[model samples]
Target: MTAVRFKPTLLAALMAASLFQSAWAVEPFVLKDIRVEGLQRADAGTVFASLPFRVGDTYTDDKGSAGLRALFATGLFKDVRIQVDGNVVVVVVEERPVISRVEFVGTKEFDKDVLVKALKDIGIGEGQPFDRALADRAEQELKRQYLTRSLYGVEVITTITPTERNRVNVTFTVTEGEVTKIKSIRITGNQAFSESTLISQMDLTKGGWLTWYTKSDQYARAKLNADLETIKAYYLNRGYLEFKIESAQVVISPDKQDISIAISVSEGPRYVVTGVRLEGEYLGKEEEFRKLVTIEPGEAYRADAVAATTKAFTDRFAAFGYAFARVDFRPELDRAKGQAVAVLVAQPQRRVYVRRVNVAGNSRTRDEVIRREFRQFEAAWYDGQKIKLSRDRVDRLGYFKAVDIETVEVPGTADQVDLTITVEEKPTGNLMLGAGFSSAEKFTLTASVKQDNVFGTGNYLGIDLNTSKYNRTIVVSTVDPYFTDDGVSRSYDLYYRTSRPLNTQGGDYKIVTPGGAVRFGVPFTEFDTVFFGAGVEQTSIKGDTGLPVSYRLYRDTFGETSLSVPLTVGWSRDARDSLIAPTRGRYQRLNLELGVAGDTRYLRGDYQFQQFIPLSNRFTLGLNTEVGYGKGLSGKPYPVFKNFYGGGLGTVRGFEQNSLGPLDIEGSYVGGNRRVNVNAELYVPFPGAGNDRTLRLFGYMDAGNVWGEKDSMSFSDVRASVGVGISWVSPVGPLKLSYGKPFRYQDQDKIQRLQFQIGTAF
Candidate 1:
């Protein structure tokens, strides 16, 4: 047969018209029943099932064409045809190849399962037929994940292998090239501070010994942002309000594992606050509130002072029932002289009475549980003190993720407000059953069941059990937080426990104790509290064969019943967002106890200080120190149970548990006479998560010593340790793991590590 040739454009037009004509010719047969073919993988009913319109429905020329178009668009068919057979429509399609399996090769940066999910996210993978478009998308997404980690020269190739049952096996071959690490950070135009000083402020680090695990040396865009903020804050705190980061460049080295950072800074003249003006409604009480502003006109410009002043004004207005008050500062800058004036604008809207106070978002907690904490009532004038107390009360519950109070205006009433108190519920059940293995403790199983709020009532109950020769304990306790609604937190606990130290002399010394205590917390001020408590205890010693004569004499004196009245008073102040990983805050606690009425008498006091100092947005330094002392009173021997013990992970990780205490009569250490401890932690986020508070990395240094008395304290006996650890907020719970090495020790010994539980704190 001779082939007929024509212009390319004309041939394409003719083919398109022929397709249209064929579609028109099927119009008559469309009215008949439809038949389907090609059923190797998909059943005939499955193909007919996907059709939009049913059989015997009206089918015009447009309908037949629409049907064929829809079948091909599913990507399930490689070819589709519609033919007419005398009042019958025959539909045939060639099913596309289906994917049977997926595999990956030569990829270390990403896991196979992760790549599968990534591919699935881009509308590709298993069961569905493969297409060139989907394969290309999967390749791009894989490359993007690598590039974000500074893998600029990475390459990805996809291979499709044929398989039985018309299926294909997809494989992704990835060449992840190299990962770049920051080699050095150079800061230019920084005359006020040294380059090293400024770079240290940044959370990102250059390649160092710790870089392999920390990966902090990797070049990331987020790291650049955080570094800029560090620079800005450093200058601002030093009175450089107009300082700015001009530009930054990240250069890669030949090996791709080395990078250099260069940053340009513009430090403008420092400014001093020359004047402050109030420019809004005074409500005849301007003088009364103006005195509350802590900012001085001649002082250096401080961002904190401005924020405090604005808060004071807003709170003052809110105190007068102005729930819709707004306060803002407008700074008038005189660049020529490098000075500025702050105009405080205050707008106090009409006083609004609360129509209703609704609490929302508390799924686990009862509505009444939160409502009882509210001091503000419906249909009453808004009181700032009560509102603040309500918020604090909610915060104290320790059962909520967040507590927010929002004032909503009533549409028709300008003087009416509807307060919405929203609370996010947190896990309240503290019960934990855990097991672990360690070289020191060996296999250990620990179980604890505790409820902060028992049965929707504000009572606490707990039981603890541990089975291990190194550490064994059993205890039961109960407490009622609100014995009376007068803001006094009353609590009581009863416990019976027995413990035997694994590292005892020839034989372990055992102590069986049963005790009960009652405590009441009296609030002296918003930030201070005084606690009073009394208790009765009975302790007995066993395994006397291994005990010293002094120990046996002490036990005989304080035998079966030890009647004691312990007067306790403590105070604490909290100013932080999170008890864990706090960036800024100061916490102070002072505790004292005197056993005046007891078989044994003594006096003990402990003082602790915790400060979270933020070096920058991405780095926080947590400092903790504690000092404690105890002395015998009224010519009586010191209470053995009241003595202080050091060593262990909670105290000094390198030393054994309670190993730093005094030596017992059996020539074994029992407890310390006095103790001092200090720990410093630097916290940063885990890499790749991007500002996720759920996990973090920390480096810590701990130092402490236990001595017989103040005069007996010596640096020679001090124990010190340095460690790196990881913390995570897992779905099951919060977890911490640490590996420590002793720096200062009494003798040459292998590094001893321990893992302890530190639960979620408010």
Candidate 2:
């Protein structure tokens, strides 16, 4: 009896052990139903969709674990669990708190919206899940931004407050301390060049009067790296073949208000070029390739020269439809003798054709407007020159802030490429209202509205109004660049002007001019245009006291008012590198006006030329000259209203406005029928601004004179002045301020030394 009982008990215990082992081993079972719980903001379907197992599907421990992981990976929940009860799967989750609002306090360095957007980029913003990790990352990002601006002493504190409905509000408290400025920069291990000279070549600098504008005193790692590269290049270009920057260190004061930088460099032995030879195919133009080489034997080795030579070769190859061309210079150095030999290697992989041209980032401008400026056509051989010229033409339109071009190889094709041109569009329309003070003009009010790309149709419209003590003028103008679709341009202009004597406060004695004109510009060449126009003008003299003698004589002979029909012809050629601030180029213009049928019959002509020469990377020399001649025809005297006036900001800076001319019996300027002016300027970067061209200091010399119909032009009688000026391209407009002293002037001459104006191009 005892043996039989023991056998039964042992069999039951074994069966129980087998059942427990099967439960832990993930035995598959058919799911009867699936349920999700604890969902507040998220929909039930969202949780159900993320589960790996569904109703009527097989369920196992693997599926349960996977479902839990999938739910948690969505980041919509803080905790997730999967429970199986008699083949029914239940999913339980605790949802994460959503951010209700984000706020900043005691933050004056940046706008609140800017900070919010920055945080949003990093997954920490309103309507996003609140997590401690995200908050910490956001705080670090804010601190990093402040560090870039030299605010090294900045601190940030984040606070999270719980609200109703599983939501929270976040606030960031910031402390922005005084900006740290660079105190000094020192260079060690430099025996070849002076420290001052090396520092001058860098953009970073010690604090100065212009530090607020230039911000060169701000400490930035990228700027320091760039300065180091500049130093390396400076040495490399001056025959230091093995120049290197060994190390750089930056130190901050305890107060975090001053920064000091030190750079160590090694200057290798100076090297001379012993020979330069070409080692690759030159399309049977060996002589041409040799001529293109800038590096010559017996001269000091220069990296710039080598780069230029390689670039020239590459461009030459691209001109022959070899778009995938490579040109490299291999320098063979002889350290013992300090001599080097350069070998240029060229490889023309394949000649490719442009399959298509794509334009982007011009939302406002029409595609055709940009397409018409391109010289390279689709399904044509790639011409680098044409592509570059097209980009330059688009830039010259002045419609976009930046234009970039890229070449992309077409996939699965060996001899095809696609050209992409991207442009950053700026506001083509400008509205300006300005006030300025000058010794001569005193206070002037000026307003203007201009649109270069009107409605994105490549048209121009403008209105100008000026109210000054001595002059008042209004002008309206419009231009259609593609009037006939063949690069012909048409323009219309209407103007009304009134002028008074500068010496008098009353506007009783004045001249009034009202005119309208229609012009057409015909493109004669790549850089040349001819303009022809016809206009009707009427000039009237008001009052008699303090009136110029020429005006009085004209009024007495031709009545108070004279009507004229004038026809004008002009030609212009511009090759300037930039429209706003040209470093090197030539600009020439010639205009002629003929009064064929009018009360005053006259012929007037003017020629002007401007040339800019880049003396170095930091200096530019500019020369300008203008000449005018007018004579009366058909026994009529030249209209005094048509005379040219000198001695102003645009002409002679040291003299009063329109005062360098013949005087009437009342000692008022009468202008002249002939005029000549010459100006020369040397432009240098503003102190502490490094190589920035926007703000510059210029020394200028000006000489000009105006001659009446009976007077003779003489160089000795010309008034001359020398002065210094500042040119700044501000956000509002271009501004000019000058202080002059007349070197050659008569006691009778009206002299105004200080001048300033806004919205005038340099």
Candidate 3:
């Protein structure tokens, strides 16, 4: 190669001449013809269109090089070349095989969607060219995801199908073999606590009746750390002073479904603290901080005590707005005697105050609702506890989907802070549409539209409509929370409904009712609330002919002038970390309804209590109890409209729907004089899985009965049944399927034998 220097005009002309000479050096192959080969999956026309130089085009070094690069970049070929013969450019290509089909075989654990997504993630998707490298990566990733769930020894095979247009279909036939279960757990170097006790601390459990559903038998590495923490806490609480997890090993069986966990623990010598010292300025209030410290001289060197002291100092600094304060413990260890001296160091920087609070992401809720919950106000010293409380308050509003608070320091200012609160709004409206099926009513559809917060103004409005063989309703309701300001939640609702209880044996009864209610909520504490409300109900009985003897008697006595004031008070506490997947929390609700001021009235009350408790990572226990009792006031029999009825899938699954009340004509329930129901359920997960407790096998025991007015509630009349069922939180709502066999039934009682219901909270 030679370098040429020339004037601007000469440079342009000389470059053109040099390019022509170089093109001619390549023999000026004037593509007299073109031939494409080795293209099994691609059309020849498409291949020719992709060529840089087509037929009859003079082949140049640059054009041929560009053609090869373009073909290679398309990823449709393993080899591509361009040959020139007397101006004839031949395009030669070895096309990559196309994928015609994808399939999975013997893969019971993971669904096809899961595998397809995994393959697509790695660029080995269906209908694309098949490359061995991509398939290998896909297989590896699948195995990794499976092994994470303790599924080992899984195999994947690729199957290719030759199809039309030189295209080929590929399938990944996978053999996801049996998942491994825990064989046994062996704990070493433990003397204080028994092996069984330690194993109980671990979420992984041995195979049992519940284990088949919970799959707690599989060993996970993450569970080891949690179990170690439990062991450390246990030993420390018992005065072990120093305990450590030395090593943990999980061995899987050859079948890949069985596993064994071995944990080694080191219980160090216990030490008593000789003394404690404080270093650094404690805001010039040494005495105050000295009193705040929980760790004292001559006390045991407990980790918990040390943590507590650190927290106390940190919180004290935070109270002064020094939220970034650092507290470190320089422990003086006496190795020879195994004793410890605690010296606390604190660095409380300049105090800062909140300058302004900004809220964002609340497109539905009014900004004031979030601002009212904030405790860290402008010009106030920053406090961690107050900020956390503010966050919790925003979360408790139930209007926001998410809430977050972040603090920022103002530039060039030592005592300035800015709080940014971000919140995401959730759908506060509840739309309910229900349909019921039974041997008596056949099928019924019910629907309602309600909004808890309307137009971000904290007002509620709703319309409800329902149609069924036994009942029909159409109502309009509205509520205004800002009626009086001061953060008082007030609600008012009005409604009109009609009911016609199914007459099983030659009876006809129907009633039309109109009512209205007003309620005000009183906030007791962060986790507790009380609501008070009053309502008026009027039920006009029509077509009471051929009705049950009890219903007929009620219509004749009350004459449809049943003006009543329904008084209700409710209390609830929700401490569950999550409304769903609550592993350690408690929720309780109690509702009481009392008839206070109503014509032809009596005193009546309905009570219900629900409790949810998490027994372990894989099990939860839920209990529900309800009782309804009503009687005629001033020696009048109870109104038939207020009478309670039971049975069916939502209640006792082994009994016919609404057949548990007092019998009237030939074994038909005339409506109960009093009602009681109690249900206890235990939910466990499916075997060998993650936290997807979506499908749970549950066992429930239900007991209670409805009785006549003279049949004072007694245990002798209580009917009981135990059943096993499956619960699924389906897309629509909660679905429960129960198969109960009644353990107690009278000779004339009708039983459902087995029942299942969907989309019901009960």
Model 3, 1-762: lDDT tens digits are 998765333343345435534563475556678888776757887777767776667777776656665666677776665655565666777777777677777777877898788878887776787776677787788888787677787787777677886566666676777767777888899987898877766667766665665667765677667777877877775556768888888877666767788889998876778888999879888899989887866766777788898998988888878978899999887867867788999999778888898998987788886787677788787887788889988887678778898888899888888999998888998988777654445566768898877888767788988776776778787866545555557777778888766456655657788998888877767557788898988888777565666666666676755677878888877766656444455666766666766665565666666677788656888877887777767665667677788876656668877788677765446667588888988988654433456677889988888887877777877887888887767676666677888897776667876676544455
lDDT agreement with native, every candidate: 0.75, 0.87, 0.74
**Residue 542 in model 3: lDDT:** 72
Q: Kindly list the per-residue Cα lDDT of model 1 for residues 575-641, writing each as its tens digit.
A: 8767765788998888898888867788899998999988866678888898999988899977765
Candidate closer to the true structure by lDDT (higher is better), 1 or 2: 2
Clash totals in order: 1, 0, 24
- The candidate 3 region of ten consecutive residues with least summed lDDT is 7-16
* Candidate 1: clashing residue pairs, number: 1
Candidate 3 stretches greater than 4 Å from native: 1-106, 126-132, 159-170, 255-257, 271-319, 329-345, 354-381, 397-486, 490-514, 522-534, 541-558, 565-762
How does candidate 1 score on lDDT? 0.75
What is candidate 2's CA lDDT for residue 665?
A: 67
* Superposition error at 238 for model 1 (Å): 3.8
TM-score per candidate, chains pooled? 0.68, 0.92, 0.62
**Weakest ten-residue segment in model 1 by summed lDDT:** 8-17
